[model samples]
Target: MLHIVACIKQVPDTKIIKMNPKTNTMDRASAPAILNPYDAHAVEEAVRIKKRYGGIVSVLTMGPPPAVKAIKKCIEIGADEGYMISDRRFAGADTLATSYALTKALDKIQKIKPVDLILCGKMTIDGDTGQVGPGIARRLDIPPLTSVKKVEAVNQEEGHIIVHRKIEDGYEVIQSSLPCLLSVEKEINEVPYSSFPNMVKAARYEPHIWSVDELEDVNIKQLGLKGSPTIVAKVWAPPKPEGGKIFEGTPKDQVDQILSVILEKNELFQAKGGY
Candidate 1:
């Protein structure tokens, strides 16, 4: 049976997030965290693929102790097993360090059983950079594809996979070998409702937690904040724009006034039938 693992993350519920003006960081305690919306779609797609092809769908996440809940969310979404890599040493990780830690954990997961495919969301809302999926692929020396919109086909015996990739203005179809990583977009799949049994399993499931020492060839210089090259030198809330003039009039009068003002600003708008 094919072994598929999906990487997921937990992020602060950004809709209700509070920011710290002093440190210019998120006020995490003020907001409830949830499984990343995009990761949820990735897990859903992996589960669907397993259901069709017959395989196990496992999830792995690296975060603080609270991140275990994100793994459980994957279980609730129909994953069979979940792995969590939590440690103080993993704190303040940027994409580079985060992928390093994830690569170490994935190495452990592969040792027990060879993984056929690794799935990930295109990007995390908090980080905004969709680099971790490809980063993990780089560390593992596996082929990685990003912006996947559809899994056109999979051939386990011949070791082939075909997928549609999202691109500006259109899409592209590409084929690659197996044991590959795919970073998928949300439009690729719909997350289904979790079965009761799966919900129970997820609630009771304990993930395989690993520490810094557990990694095979981990370099302390590249495992956490120290290993990360990027840093948030400064941060602040978006500055509100200056006050604006509000125009009020009937629909026709308003249009005329607006056009007059616009034409006044730009002389090019004076021509008839001109945009």
Candidate 2:
């Protein structure tokens, strides 16, 4: 049976998240944590592929203990198994260090079960760089098919898969070899509501959690903050746009008011020789 692994992450709900005025950083505690939306689609696509081709789907993540919640959420989406690597050493990792750490975990997973294909979301909500997926593929020396919007076919026998990759104006069809990695677009599939049985399984599920030590041949210097070279100099919220004047009157009066405002601006411009 084919073994497909999907990479996922738990991120704070960005829409509801707030920024700390003092620190000028994200206030993670202000919002609830949830599965990354793009990664959810990746997991859903993996499940669909399994249902179509008759294989096992596994999900992997690198995060803290609370990330187990994200793994369980994947289970509810129909993933067969989940794995997580969590530790303080992995804290404050940028994309480079993160991909390095995850690549190590993936190596372990590949040894346990030969993975036919690897799947990932286009980007994470927290870090929208969309670099980790391609970075992992590069480290593994495999082809990275990014912006995948549709999985046309998975010809396991032929050891190749066909997919539609999104482009600027339209999408293009491409065929890639097996063991390749895909960074899928959100439009790839619509994730449905979780089934009752899946929900039950998710509630009772406990994923395989590993620390940095559990991974084999890990380079200590390349694990976390020590490995990260990129530095965030500063962060601040954008100034809110000035509010427009409200015209409280009938349609004719509102139109007249707008015309008057336009004429006033035009006169000001003319005064400044802006004919």
TM-score of each: 0.90, 0.90
Distance (Å) between predicted and true CA of 9, model 2?
Answer: 0.6
Per-residue alpha-carbon lDDT of candidate 2 for residues 165-267, written as tens digits (9 for 90 to 100): 9999999999999999999999999999999999999999999888988999999899799999986766676898999899978999999999999999999
**lDDT of each structure?**
0.90, 0.95
Best by lDDT: 2
What ranges in model 1 sit over 4 Å off? Answer: 239-256, 259-275
